[model samples]
Target: MTTEQHIRHRADGSIDTAFYTSQGRTRRSEAAHSMARGVIGPLVILFSFGTLVALLV
Candidate 1:
């Protein structure tokens, strides 16, 4: 995800491997947020497809 895009780079042709925890968000919260963001799109698409099939039937 683009969540790490900001932290994944440095301007001096090196990777930024050092990360500090809980900059207003814990690792758990960040993971849950990422999971929800990932799931919502597919769930919406799947449900909409199901609804369309049901209506057609």
Candidate 2:
């Protein structure tokens, strides 16, 4: 894979959202995965929690 591809995609051919969505920046990328196992799992949970907190507050 090319360096540019490596920045956007993981080694397993999966799109790495973390790469494009880092440092409070986003790229309008699809931010979903079939299974949340790698770095995304915790982010999903953390963002969920933050959303809940905001709604409840």
How well is each residue in 1-57 modelled by candidate 2, as lDDT tens digits?
Answer: 646533467899898878756733532223333343567888999999999999999
TM-score of each: 0.45, 0.36
Off by over 4 Å in 2: 1-36
Q: lDDT tens digits, residues 1-57, model 1?
A: 445445555678676545343443577888898999899989999999999999999
Clashing pairs in 1: none
* Model 1 C-alpha lDDT versus the unseen true structure: 0.75
TM-score of 2: 0.36
* Stretch of 10 with least lDDT, candidate 1: 16-25
* Per-residue lDDT of 31 in model 2: 39
